[model samples]
Target chain A: MNATSCYETLGVVRDATPEAITAAYQRCLGELRASLNGPNPPPPERLDALRAAYQTLGNPAARQAHDAALSPPTPAVSADEGERRPYPFAFTGEGGEYFRIWIVNLFLSLITFGIYSAWAKVRRETFFHRNLTLDNSAFSYHGNPIAILKGRAIAVVLLIALSAAQNAGPFAYGIAVLALLPVVPWLIVRAFRFRAHNTSYRGLRFSFHGTYRQALTAFVGYGLLAAISFGLLFPLFYRQQRTFVLDNLRYGSAQFHCTASNGQFYGIFLKPIGLALAGMFAIGFLTAAGGAPKLLLPLAFGVGTMALMLFLLPYIRVRTTNLVWNHVSLERMGFSSKLAVLPYFGLLAGNMVLLLLTLGLYWPWARVRLARYRASCMSLLSAEALDSFVAGESANAAAVGDEVSELMDIDIAL
Target chain B: MIAADYFDGRSSRRHPATLGLRDGTVVVEGDFGRRSTALGAVEICTGADQTLSTIRFADGAMCEIRDSAAWAAELAGAGIGADAVAHAERRWHWALAALAGAVLIIAASYAYALPWIAGLLAPAIPQAVTQSISDTVLKGLDGGLLAPSKTSPQRQQEIAAKVAALAGPGQLPPHRLLFRAGPTLGPNAFALPGGDVVVLDELLALATRDEEVVAVVAHELGHLRHHHGMRQLLQSAVVSFVVGVYLGDVSTVVAGLTALLLESRYSREFELEADAYAGRLLLATPASIEPLIDTLLRLEQAHAKRRAADRGGLFGATDLLSSHPDTAGRVNALRAMKR
Candidate 1:
């Protein structure tokens, strides 16, 4: 008998009724039972198989489900059908709803002397993850609070040790800082692994496959190069870091590919510097050429500097996010982002203003607002069905790296 | 029965299903298949605000119940209730209570707890560290806010000796007096962590008599004796650090400025404390507390004049964010102490 279906196992056709299936099951079981006492007795496992088949096909609900599973899948939408519009990511989180969670977390954390912070982190991440949807499927976070607490404890200890070393003397401080240099890359990699392994979409977990050696080269070696070159090589370093992170990321069986070039990163960072320099030159030309009053010179410089400062950060952030995400792909699925610089800057400025006005009470609302805006600007650049990807082998990553990096304020975009 | 999305965990496939609890078994029947597992065999993750409850089977299959209310009700009917944290998070009143509790706790800690902790901890810092901090702070101020003293060497020595006589000997951390020309700082005197009393030239010029200068230095010596500088540093460090922890996503500039404003209150208390110390010391000497009172009045006049001239840079941060106590309060406190 074919083992593929219950009907086949019972020597019955697909359209067999419940009575027919039960009869087939009874006959098969009797035959096996009667031969049990013979020298060439049929195995008892055959009887068990017959009973199992009978059990499933005997139930109407189970039979209907079985039939559905056996049916062929519907054809996927073809690309040539002109239905290739990207799927927009949506954030359904509300300010008032999140504020409750944030306040409660804060209160608990304080009362527990910060021990509850680990649980708070889990809840916050879960809140964000569950609210974020792509193509109607939400993501999920499954981080353990105990792991986070342990990591935070270790990070606090390290922080105290570092401070103590600083007070001990220059030599001790140097040794402490130098020791941390190697650990930085390790922590970065671990953080990536921990974050990715815990995030899930459609029951398939994301993962990071980057090794420590690669992280060190990207974060430390290139970081040193950027620093030694007085930040001239910073764009290259940034590209390397992003590539190292993006290229190693995996969603189920498909690996994410980042085709973002170093030159693109250079363009993202250099344009602002170029604009600031031009503004400076223009100001200088006006002042020297007697185009404006000398009394307004300091004001002009101050305004110019402030404008440049405001423009630079938002511009770089928007351009880099668009550059990196737009060039990223997971198998046939691609990513897109249209985060405009001015709107982002406006949002941030408004958030800061309201934050000040409310004396930090605007924190939860600000986060929700930012999350909504960010989600709006992002999309999946694919028309292909999302269910084709398979789950990969799951692994547990220690939260120490993630928590420590968080404590150190190292922002690694996922 | 609750409608849910089920995943076999072998692939990223969604199977629309209906889940039911029967005889301690969770049965998920859907288009794809039917899975019935003993309730005790599956893991149930509690739901929170707007998040679904997840039920995981031993074979890596899982189900997500999207209707939080219905799922919660079902779980309750089945004797599986929300966890303690989730229960607390479910209510608006609890959240508000937590907020009130947190605010009260933080305020109480800032007002009473931090001062007590800093006072106990400040004197316990190693002497070498305190000395290093003093040197670093003064060096950082030099050549920028402070220039070399323009006062004649003789006058500087005379005032230093008078202040030294006031402090007396056998002070655990012996005091050292230094003079600098603080044109930018303008009529200020401060004590450092390791018993360094710095008196600016502008401050000396503001005084009418030599005894007034000694009184000002004597006030700074009071700060040294109480380790107010070190205590202030410790308190502010803790404040900024806690603010940073609590507001991790906030801009560092904003957090630091907020910490600074909050810390000004503590500084005012320290100032008044140093003033009382100065008043007591002056009462023991022939100069009396009259000079210290006069110096405070003079400094207040100078500060007000500078305030008018500067037009309140950074939106009058100088007066609003001033670390020093108001002159009236300091003078009144000193007068009361003198009696």
Candidate 2:
């Protein structure tokens, strides 16, 4: 038997044709399906493994990276090599450096009647990615601005249409809503693919393999369930989406696995809301006992609720980031996040104060600080070198999805 | 000699190689393979960082060079690609220059281009859309704070006839007069996008002369003639659009609130343009310019008195005297042209 990286995982030979790879993946899945039907259902874990392998091989970029790992060109002698130690991310970007680019981008984008915004997006993303380095290599972004502009046009048309419909009448709005419902899942899936396909580390591109059917179930199917349940079931949908996105992702051929459960996500969502309510109740009880004025009672309750939300916001963010990072792994290589609640909260509060105080002139500095904090908190731990894998699939994400959501002015929360 | 890493394009394998240029030939040697390609066969790229450069072979193989001065010099001399080192940005003051340039552009756009573009685009938008916007805004105001005018039907007719008289021959006014008791808007008279000139009872109470009320109607007519209301809306929308693109974080409700504030903001130019149009109209007619200037002064006093009377009212933002153009400037301009 061949050593199972991705090719061996799918029972394919090295240098397998694209059709052969597809056939192999299908054959593997079909065999698993047969075994389940024959009254001995293979464990879901085995099915997951097979799916990961299929995703890895199916993507051109991942397959290329996997093939390279299976056959290295030379022996390495590195000063840093010992046991695979955790590589901390370092951000070399100075705020001053970034501000110049920012001003130039802003100036050009302004003078061009905003047509240069697409190029600005590229420049901006590349600047941040290049500055955040790990393992002596920085990440790279490869997206065509022309493609993004095309996407922007599509997004604006869709946006104007929906907005016009909403302003026309409630019936027109309802019709537009019905028409857009099905496209949400499709857009979510496309957005995931677009972001992943353009991202590369160590010359190897990352790819997402989530299917349209999977996206539809995770987004719309569960969205309806949440709506039916008065939003209580939203955590289940969130977990489903994370799994759908994380599991299908392949950096080279090393699969990223996320095992966050519905309960964990629910805990994160409810903590802030529950605390705010409790705080309001406590303030109400205290003020009533103290014989406070009616106006003062409302003022106390409002301040209490606001404070509670402010405190819980960072708590939820920190814990949720932990849940995502600690549970996600590439093969056995895990991603660990050391983001603490108070420190993260400090960052958030400080960022807000800075933004308010500087009239937004300190925006570049704020961005740099946030990026630095996020990068510093995370580290990849593994025994194998990350650079050995390569993938060829360059799935150019339809820029329209990003621009569509952009025009809609909605962040697609996963 | 230059130390570089090679990727054959077909595989993810990294080969540590020494690169040297010899008589227009680029030679790369490593444990995996020794390959030579003509310097012209490889496309070179200058990277963002000074020392990071990449050369791509015709076969899609790539070589990344670090600290690549000698090889870069040779390739640059041959015009392989622009030298990254040569293209490195200027020190320190470039930021200052960029800041200056940005400020200059913003000032230019704010002072000249924004109004010009708004004026050009306002007419191109379908009249139907503007009408619908007007109808919707009026409907909202009516259901909330606006009641039908307390003024007698006879008084309303008098104002309407005066507006028609001001329109004179060959030029029909775009709007008809509408009156309401605007408890929320508070002593305001403004033209909606679809040429609806709404004058509240509070504003009418401030008018002491028949000529004063006629001047207000004439000013509102001027707004309709040049589509100033729609032009103002379009200009602010453009401002918000630019802000949205530049700032780029619209996911929050805060950003939407900011957009709301921006859209409501009327530029000083638009206010003056409407003022000029009114000034020219009033001067040409039997009505003198004094009524227009007097009405503006009275309107400011009416607003100031209202603010002083109730600071706790719905319209708490009474910094209007500072926000709008100095009423004195508009009056002076009108007076100078009257002579």
Write candidate 1's Cα lDDT for B95-181 as tens digits.
889889999999999999999999999989988989999899889889467899999999888887776677557742478878899
Tens digit per residue, CA lDDT, model 2, B219-330? 7777777777778777776676667665554234556556556644455555676777777778867767888898889877877777678777543444432245478887
TM-score of each: 0.76, 0.80
**Ten contiguous residues minimizing lDDT sum, candidate 1 chain A:** A72-81
lDDT of every predicted structure (CA atoms): 0.83, 0.73
In angstroms, the error of model 1 at A203 is 2.1
After superposing candidate 1 on the true structure, give the runs of residues whose Cα lies further than 4 Å from its correct spot: A1-87, A160-179, A224-235, A261-308, A336-346, A381-384, B31-34, B37-41, B46-51, B135-191, B196-221, B242-260, B275-324, B334-339
Best by DockQ: 1
Quote the TM-score that chain A achieves in each candidate: 0.79, 0.77
lDDT of 2 by residue, A78-159 (tens): 5223454687777777776677668767767777878988987877777777677777666667677998888887887887
TM-score winner: 2
